[model samples]
Target chain A: MEKEISDPTLTVSGQRGPASHERRIQIIKSAHEHFLQYGYKKTSVADLAKAIGVSSAYIYRFFESKQAIGEAICSVVLGKFVVALHELASSDMSASNRLRKLYITLLDMSLEMFFNERKLHDITIAAVEERWCTTTQYHQTKYEVITKIIQDGRASGEFERKTPLDEVVMAIVETLYPFSHPILLQHPILLEQSEPEVLHQRAIAVSNLVLRSLAP
Target chain B: MEKEISDPTLTVSGQRGPASHERRIQIIKSAHEHFLQYGYKKTSVADLAKAIGVSSAYIYRFFESKQAIGEAICSVVLGKFVVALHELASSDMSASNRLRKLYITLLDMSLEMFFNERKLHDITIAAVEERWCTTTQYHQTKYEVITKIIQDGRASGEFERKTPLDEVVMAIVETLYPFSHPILLQHPILLEQSEPEVLHQRAIAVSNLVLRSLAP
Candidate 1:
């Protein structure tokens, strides 16, 4: 189900007392870890507050609820993805080369997120499934960042002009999203004997298909 | 978590007594529904047992545990996928026409499975992630079916001799796999407002790319 965050008005840039901002960041980071470890259903707001050494009220003071905390976590991760793609687009590499790099980088980031922060990944999957905080400005901003990269590539004749940039971005996003969610990637029977190399090879093969499609 | 089924020996063939076989099929169907409704973690063996009007032990009598049930569920779904692909391959159509039909059929089948059999899709994602049942007889059977199609197309001079059939099959499977998993496609903030037409267009575009790569 899509989690609903009550305080859609909250912003990372909103004016706050220095101490309050610091505490909020602490709570968010702690909550991220807790959510990653126990998942959204199992990790309570109180658990996050306790982990951050703050009162539940303090957490509320910064955010509204567990769902709000989840939005923040997803925003942080997706924000990272956008920023990296933007950097790749701006680099001196050719459009096709840059796109390939972006694909590989995105895959690596997803794998890292899956292995390192499984709880947050789980929370993100829940958020995505439930359509939680999807209408929020934060998500729109991230989408724009991705769209801009494709637009830039097209404008510079780096990508095929006929291809729909927005659709390509969405497909790539959909393709890479599962690898970030450990719960989606963990196959019990396959895990018994499948080496990491095998999984990595599969990721590379998928990336190649996406990259091939995006090439000019 | 890797769901461990107790007796990995009970195959899905209508082998156990007729009553037992019918009961097993019913349990799998109920379990599939539960998986779709609550996901893998939230759907317990007890929940499945209750839904199927059987005791947990009765459920276990046919399969071993929740994980074993998951394996059976995925095997059933994937088995269907392989069968569909084989049918497409064996049809008396031109190679290019067969490829096109194969793409469209797979896409429709996958989307149907994703939306209708949510539980089976969830179990498959878990199976893929955990690397469980990777080298299973089912996958081998699937590979052979796909390879046969490519080999037939190649011998008929319908596809480029340089095209790697194994790689192409892998690409098709991997690309479609992500879309079949709801957790990847159902991002609330990122995809909640996303139009289905956009997704359809993206699928068509990617299929075209795959086809172009195989063209002689």
Candidate 2:
């Protein structure tokens, strides 16, 4: 087994200067593009380094290996997903309305990622299957965040208390996970329909079903 | 692409007698074992032939290639699933009772397939991703069988009329698909716990939720 290490250059501390931050973002964006086009199995460190105009040794300074970089990309995407849900949690809307908005936002984000950021989805799936510990912890954190929001809704008398918060959160995540991952939608059977309008309607329908189930 | 030809040997026509039927079933069983051990990508025609105590040329006499054998295995499994649902549809139980039984049956069948017939699950996942036109048609046929059961319930006043049959079908299939497929369960994250009992209970809970929503 290879030792995996996290990227040190891309700090979340918000202490990096603008130039450093911009450079880091540039490398990440380049890597993301390469991974999406070629997939994790085919993408090489040298390829990514060449694309980013850096030596392979210098690329290693930021990430330990291709797998580490892929994990970082997944972390970035999942972090963004958590932030979006948090934003929804902070809103002053009814529980059902917040959930409705959350679903729509998630579906749109997924479509954008599917069309433009497919590599991230592949990395995430690999992380889930291969890097189970990290992926499970990440899911636990996200589940906690969503569970807290549901609990808050119950406290505010905006949602029912009948359903278990954990179950509801898991169900919601399970229902939306397919739409969030491009590999799933990439199925030819699912892609048979060309109308974006119809696909959007299907997402809305699924969202509505979840909301109705959670309704007080 | 190689010329696509349907397996005349697998057809239910009178051309294949009892002995041929028995041989086809034996081939599927042997191929299933090979798939479980090596996955769809790694499993070869020669491997299956060796496992079945036959020459590679003899294997090809019945099926075109390794992929065609996989298709045959999937068809056998799916055919059994269709038969189970058809029997459930004709039962005279109340809607809620029938739904409960259906959920339990699916969970049990999925577990059985996941543990005992892992190769079939592996091939099915490959079939889904490869979008072999035959696999897609097989899925559609399975969906149609389930849809007709739901439709029968609706017409017989056994189920509520307002439920979205397609969405319900998708949700049920999606939820059970991974649980049924051994490859997905082989992930360490899923293997960490006793899943069969918990999953069976969850299936019941989800079915109840759907039935409550659909009840008139």
Candidate 3:
């Protein structure tokens, strides 16, 4: 509740005719920046509004609470991840290669945020636990991406068709839990290797296990 | 808290020579029953002593708090799961068969708890989130069982050595997460089938995916 930040109009003074939707995006971005800087539990709505040079009341028009902002941040991050997986899945690489790359990317992104970007990772974990609508959509889309890859793999005669495609895709993600799951990754027994190379090797091994499990 | 329940001598009136440790075991069993009969959050220390015909103070002599009793109950349940896994892992069945049976048992037990024993399922979830020490130990022991099975799989020429055996074991558990995880079992997408037979088929499908992944 900074006195100086109480004026949303003044904050937008430099712009000639900023639309309400554009301002909402600006608010979301500013809140996301605050999250990355201050961590999830510590970042207050007032802090986010002050950082954006807007009044807390002004920010309230856009978001209901800090939890809303946090969900938006996670949606953005996970959206980007799903987009990356879709891109790789749609590429010209062999279906098997695409699936492997998809998991490698997944493992890398999750681990990077977890180990290097601790604040952001904590926020993401909170969002996940809350199971926001966006998180559900992200999982749904992720399932489709894996499903598409399996469909392609089946068409190419690369993967065995012994199980239903949906089940196989689900099993692949579920089995690779140790390599990509952030919470499970935190367990000392699953994560003795701190070196990125060692961990990457583990991810690769896991990806290979998935690939081989589906081989024709 | 009841005056008469605190009378330890009266609680064990007929016992000529009761060891303190043995009494502790009896207290754990009584608390476990109360937990099953009345969910963890509702089951109080006084209620436990009342059920056991002992004083609340006497219950404290054998246990620290209600949380400790809850944890002990979880420990006993998870210990049984680990033992079941170990027995299958050590049996004369082929390592592939053993692994498949292991996951089948896991999925069945988890789903059974979720669907048939709602109170116990809630208690399990609480203990999991609480990260009880025994839960940690259970995970450690479960990992060993998977590792042993993987080793036997390799020895039996059923699995290849593409990944470190440790990583492979972790991958198998991670990948089969949906079929075996209680929380995931509650998801509509994963548990569309209410019939145990249908769910068992899904577990088998997942188990085969893992088995195929490790095939030479």
Candidate 4:
């Protein structure tokens, strides 16, 4: 791995903040709920500060704006995904099974977060669509995980990839797009069928497809 | 094998239009350009009518709303894809080669439409996000094409799909998604890399992944 990515839940530097990192985490936790309920645009900094029992000035010391707070919340969510993915990567399973589990878990997590706190999903969509650094960093993390798995799969002789490693990773990521993207989860209207179970089934099938394509 | 989808470009009943079907097609052709120029929301009936040298009421006689006009444009664009796909499918190529060509052409068409007429891509995204019947019907057409190709592949002993044919088809579409979807095209910012050539390369890589997965 080029750059080791460890869990940074406690270490992610606040974009700009009051001295206490814990205080920033507290603010994010409070703001996440309000943002989800009211959406990114409707949620106000003054209101979030009030809910967090901090003055609006204090909130500003932690976040530049409502959108910034939403972005921080996004980083926290992505951080959690990374942490979970780490555990999945270390699990004692075949490379293909591990990859399959990673996608299933990733999609399920997105769907859960989307339905449970859609505001986060909405904010995440904006973060992604705007190519916000938070989303980009998360995707970078995902890319590394995929490359590592593909490398291990090749080393174990579990798969033979005809393309360059980066290209193969791109192929797998694009292949799993519909099954894993948060955008797809939020926009069931975009799919031919919106049933949750059906999407899950498709996710599994796609994993198998990728794994089959890689058989050595 | 089921649900015959053929050239209905000349036959779709206008939402509320003048008696002449040809006139409806003419109105759609005109509105398509305006929709591409000014976006779905900005372009108005009056502007479209003026551009076509007709009264706003006449425009309404051929289409119910600016959105309806947008939907018709989507239908027309989708109709063209189906026609082109038929030609490709009927060509004497291996099933994998034919499937590859279908996605390559579909994505290139989206890119061309996006760059040439961004407003149309914008409107098509709305129609898709809003689940307009035009977009859904196009998907249905795509589904049929996929089934036909897969069936041909199986009969020729090119594939041994372990899953149900629908599941296999879902895998293929999901795999081709980032390459073929209009929403993905318009939101280049959402992707990790937005360089057109890189996206095209990824599209080819994903097609090979699908074809390899299906090999008997």
lDDT of each: 0.60, 0.61, 0.67, 0.74
Query: How high a TM-score does candidate 3 get?
Result: 0.67
Fnat, model by model in order, equals 0.30, 0.05, 0.48, 0.79
User: Which candidate achieves the best lDDT against the true structure?
Assistant: 4
- Give the candidates in order of lDDT, highest first: 4, 3, 2, 1
- lDDT of model 2, residue A19: 35
Q: How would you class the docking of model 2?
A: incorrect
By TM-score, the best candidate is: 4
Name the TM-score of chain A in model 4. Answer: 0.85
Give the candidate order by descending TM-score: 4, 2, 1, 3
How well is each residue in B1-216 modelled by candidate 4, as lDDT tens digits? 232545435233337845458878888887777776677777788988999998999878777777777777776777777777667766788778889888788888777776767667677777777777776667776777788888888888888767588878888877767877776666656444567788788888888888888878
| Model 4 residue B126 distance off true place after TM-score fit, in angstroms | 3.2
> Which runs in model 3 stand beyond 4 Å of their true positions?
A1-22, A33-57, A60-70, A91-94, A115-133, A151-164, A181-202, B1-22, B33-60, B64-71, B90-95, B115-133, B147-167, B179-202
* DockQ (CA atoms), all models: 0.29, 0.20, 0.27, 0.66
Where model 1 places Cα greater than 4 Å from the true spot, the runs are: A1-20, A32-40, A50-53, A130-196, A210-216, B1-78, B114-138, B152-158, B181-198
Per-model TM values vs. the true structure: 0.70, 0.73, 0.67, 0.87
Q: Assess the local accuracy of residue B154 in candidate 4 as a C-alpha lDDT between 0 and 100.
A: 86
Ranking by DockQ: 4, 1, 3, 2
Which residue window of length 10 is worst by lDDT in model 1 chain B? B1-10
> Considering lDDT, which of the candidate structures 1 and 4 is the better prediction for this target?
4
| Candidate with more favorable, higher lDDT: 2 or 4 | 4
Docking class of 4: medium
| Tens-digit lDDT track of model 2 for B54-130 | 99987776777777777776767755665676566556765566666776776677677766765555576666665
